[model samples]
Target: MMPNRRRENAIIGLGVIALAQVRSRKRKNFWIKNCLLNHDEECPMPLLPELQENNPDDFRNYLHMTDACFHQLFALLSPYIKKRDTCMRTAIPAEQRLIATLRYLATGRSLQDLKSTTGISPQALGLIIPETCSAIIQVLQKDYIPFPSNPQQWQDVAAQFQHQWDFPNCGGAIAGKHIRIVPPPNSGSDYLNYKGFCSIVMLAVVSATYEFLFLDVGKNGCNSDGGAIMQTEFYKRLQNGSLNLPPAEENVEGLNFVFVADEAFALGENILKPFPMRNLTPEQRIYNYRLSRARRVVENAFGIFSSRFRLFLTPINLAVYKLNHVVLCCCILHNFLLRNSSSYLASVSTDEDPAVSGPAEEAASRPSVGVMTGLEPGHAELPSQDAHDIQQKYLEYFVGKGAVPWQEIVADYLI
Candidate 1:
């Protein structure tokens, strides 16, 4: 009798466990299939197939990439983002996962809003977007968004800057952009910035044609542009001579290719910032204008970046680390599209904003207005005499050899 009673109890416990799982599945299915997200006749969201067949333009608008570019990206990311089915639930299709993730990055819609359209729950998107963003950077970083590590590559970048922007031996222009985010839980004031909001910084070095040669993110917003850049590994590499920059110009023995920067950054042997705005001669004014012209590429890169990926305009509501991944992924995608998509630049002409935010939506952007020449440059550390000497050399170059037709006219207007 005892043996029989024990056998019955075991069977009863198994039955109870099975019942609980059944109820759990029911609840899960309800979240997946109920309302506008349902995969049924009454559903309103755009299906990938339907978009592919009917409205290719809408497909591009929705994903921020041409279908060809999408397929290329999807091909690379399939192995990373693909999911396997389980007994409890069928895995969301890999295509759908990519679609949902791209839409989030492209549109910067709230996860709740995305849920209604993608048939993905906000909970799922909160998980999927960052992971997909990581996959994007992992798959694309080496090729599309690489920083110049060798002297040859660095020289090539400098050559492009000289050829395109007429700034000789200029490897790149540096700019800092503030990206706002909801502060992490119990973080105290650690993430709070001078802007009276919590944010992170994206310090990038952009090529003359507006490609991102190097991007350093994850700095707290409290740090000034100089501080943020000083803390970067790039700065360490630059200071230590491990950056593998091309040989110095024939005219100057130790002067290498220079990066044009604004007042927010310090002048250095290889980094040129404009003369102080207070008092200036014609030579000084010309130098400022020339530096500003080269530096404007960084501003254009950031503006067009914000314009393309409206996500940069909206406050990203994710953890700091995940937000870093998102920023990295965007930089990668920006380069990828530049290389692959013919329509990418053409889309800039579109007046249509992909994501329209309510006024209540606190905007976080690169602040295109006052960036190229910041209004009031922060007083970081004073520069060494060597740095000043470099700036003087560039001033002479701008006035003598590198002078443009209208630079004198433009410089005089400023005075």
Candidate 2:
């Protein structure tokens, strides 16, 4: 009986050893599979946290905004983009999503590059950016870029133009910028511009403070500025006297108030363009200079905008409508920064092109014909009898009673 019991014990021991060996083999196989599938044992920590914690300058450089700005943005976006947790997996934090989107806008980095810097998968970003852009436009448009609803609001804008730019009765500066983008599937040269690239036009009316009062976007690259303006609802309303612009003020005796533009835009009662072709009169030249001075606000505004949001410098790889949303999102953010931050202008000069941020340096540069307002050529026609008379009246003022002290000095220099 003792011999039989000893033999049973030995068999039980061997069974236990075999079970242990099997479990060890399974553990080894699991690790090996994971190592093959993923290069590291766990995903690396995101780049933003480390920079934000240790190196602040790099953080601001990477995001193109201060930490306070980031917090402000996160607060604004949280209500719309915040995610709910579930049993199976945790949702990404709203802060993480905003950082990812801003990183894209600030750098215009490609998806693969962003994945490396941001640690967000390209697949996730593809969904996040467009949605975030849509949310920005949806949330910020009303308060940030609301059109002038009353005569007082319009007068307020004109007053700023007079105070800052020395131009009277000017509601806003109107211009356009080409937002480059890849061609959509099955699209022809409809997006091609004279510069030989695919683009969409962003025509905006800028206030004296460089805030965009109104925006018209999504026109094809081939659409001239004149055509784009003609197609807008703003144009229709202004033409029909429904835009609530202030009653024509006498900035100069009988001349009416108007928005200034380059010769690219068709002249109208509310729109003021410079005299076409070179003329012999000192007054016309002075009028052009003053008009150009006011108009440079839009150019500088675009320069600062493009410099602040580097996305405009790069061709966007989105559908046409998605591209429009992204541009609108950037414009709103620009205005938000202007409204909230006092140091933005000073800071932008250090980073952006001085031409846009430096209004003083722009004094010497005359408004040349066919300048870069994203307007196509061959669209402007001779001003109507009324439009020509308005231009004449303003010309008389610039060289006459309402003239600036330096108008003739600068006009003579130009001559």
Candidate 3:
């Protein structure tokens, strides 16, 4: 009986090996190229030349960039993304690649859906869009979205803050925006935030004109606003004095110009957040008003980003690493459009509520770009005396010389 059983097992093993064997496969052919994609007739333009040349408003809406800006960007990006035509088919045009990528970011349409309109197969699109976005970032990043390192540059940023926001000696406004992503693979609760879904925080420092001065992303969603910023390289730079903050001129109340945030950030030598919401005197109320008002620039910048690049409004289907590339590309384009004088870009308004937090990051609403108001403090760490003095100096300035005419009225309204 044992001998018979061993023979049966040997036979079964031999059968299993036979079933697992794979023969040399036939050379595969294009499933959806010239036959399905009528590139010469239908999608050669991405949008037709007529639409771009004739209907300017609709073109900008469709692509989220003006035609001139689009042409300029293509000139820079085409070298990086340009491809050669194979014997089988002509290459997807460089202009189409740029247009398709911009539309993908602006509309958040799936590649399958994009296929019908762009006449590019979903397979080709999957390759084209990410690569083109990477090209956009690489070509434009150094010039369009550079971080300031010189003392004169920092002072210029501070001067902008003082001139526009009535916040003296303010270098910039800082905030954290949780960019929603599909749950990272094997990242058990790692990318999950207090709000219950997976995301990566975009910690941005914005100038007064709603441009990103510096931005760091990929903070685990589980961290709070303060926690996220604290974990960034910017925080390390701030600690080590490599951030190249200008020396306190006679203008800044004997302190370095500061970046303003809401309650979720720590007070530091060059960072300020609003006072506690509860039990605030009129002076403190004024301080909160001034801080929140100045911090709105960062929020508005995020709002404009989300508004123009509709991808942020949706849960991006790409992996974590790829999504970072896409986000940076969109951010660079944001700066590009603002700096590009070809056409006027209107920003979408924000509907921010510090009281409402959770899952709002993925809202599909276009006009009302959701933001974490940062009113809810997630940190209890004590600030140093230097930080406190910086806060006091700003408070005195806001009520004294730097006060906006309407601040008291707004502060009174808040009370």
Candidate 4:
């Protein structure tokens, strides 16, 4: 009877061992089928060749710039962002890293989508994108957006304005744009703009050539444009007369050389705005038209910039510090593309001849003016006597010898 019991227990133990083996085989086969390999060759991961093989238009559409521009940008950033391989993992090629970063900026795609398309893990991309942007700024900021350190440099900018917009003694066009962003936690409505979205103001001074000469970003969207500019270091320098700006005599007999801006900015000796159109002679109206013309350069700069880096088309979801780096990097990249004589710049002529129509009329007609749609008088002081005097001088210049041939016709047609 005891021998019979031991034999039965042995049989039960053997059956249990056989069942465990079968279950282990099933699990191993499931893992092999589902996770061991990619579904197909093409689905494995994206490669650089797949993007480059497409036509030029597709390349630009995908990367937001021409191959030449991408190559140039990659060259500038490669040294700083390159990585070395380790035993655990192979390093991503510099070209791949740059292309990935540009694709992210160009499309503003989700990291998951980017991971699938670029063959980068979302975890790695989370680290790579910001690092790439920081590397780009570190590499290009000095050469692309250098502050004018001499009177001659500022004069050259003024010369470009005179040749292009026919507004003399102008340094650069100044404006502010709201970069939409997702609000951080517990921050209240500090980032909420009048436009009913969270945003940060990107204040910039643009050259006639559509380059950003100076940029100050990350101001709260709720603040007025004038208030935002006051918070920048540039404002302090301007107030102290230490920004290497030309003397007041260089612009006109009595007026200081100035930047052209909208009415939201304060009227300062160094900044020129249009006369309020409330009650004006033909001369003041004409002066407003001319100033608006020069100011369009900065407006166009913002247009081209947002168009190129469509990331700005949607609200950025990064933290404030990261958004700052991204915005400044885009500004620098804009200048870089302009410097490189990109086809994008060539396609849109910045020097469009202002014929019979004044700049304000032309600006109103274009859809791009939506970028400057939110203009309002800021909490700035009233126009100073010197600023008014400068406006008067410019008004006289336009009505006098500086007038173009069609100015007389437009002047009569306007009022």
Tell me the TM-score of each prediction against the true structure.
Answer: 0.83, 0.83, 0.86, 0.85
Off by over 4 Å in 2: 1-54, 249-254, 347-373
Q: What is the lDDT of residue 31 in candidate 2?
A: 25
Each model's lDDT comes to 0.77, 0.77, 0.76, 0.77
lDDT of 1 at 240: 92
Per-residue lDDT of 155 in model 3: 80
Q: Could you give candidate 3's per-residue lDDT for residues 1-415 as a string of tens digits?
A: 9999999999999987876674344546865656445675866454557878899877877887777888888888888988999986688878788888888999989899898778888888989988998888878899988688878888888788777666777778887878778886788999877777778878888998878888887777777878877788888998899988887874467666678887778888888988877888888889887777677778778777777788887777887788888888888889988888434344343333222421232132222336432322476589999899888887887788767666666677655
Off by over 4 Å in 1: 1-46, 249-255, 347-377
Instruction: Flag the better candidate by TM-score, 1 or 3.
Output: 3
- Kindly report which residue stretches of model 4 are placed more than 4 angstroms away from their true locations once superposed: 1-47, 50-54, 252-254, 346-352, 356-368, 371-376, 411-415
* Backbone clashes in model 1: 0
Give the local distance difference test score of model 1: 0.77
Local accuracy of candidate 2 as per-residue lDDT tens digits, 1-415: 9999999999999999999998777444342333222322233435567777898778788888877777787777799998897974456667777888998998888987886655566777888999998888888889889679888888788888877777888889988877888889888998888889988888999998889999988988888778778888888988898988766643436468799988779988789987765655777788887887788778777877887888887788988877888888998988988887665676332211223534344444433332233667546676689988888888877777777666665555555
Q: Model 2's lDDT to the true fold? A: 0.77
- For the record, the alpha-carbon RMSD of candidate 4 to the native fold, in angstroms, is 7.6
On the 0 to 100 scale, the lDDT of residue 228 in model 1 is 85
Clashing pairs in 3: none
Give the alpha carbon lDDT tens digit for every residue of 1-415 in model 4.
9999999999999999999998777444342222213422333334445656667677777787877778778877889889998975557767777888888888888788886677776677778889999999888899989679888888898888888878787888888888888999998999888878888888888887878988988888897878888888888888898878888666644456888988899988888887776877777777876787678778778888887888888878888998899888888888887777447665464535646456455544332554433433488888778777777777788888788765554544544
The positional error of residue 154 in candidate 1, measured at the CA in angstroms, is 1.1
By the lDDT metric, which is better: model 3 or model 4? 4
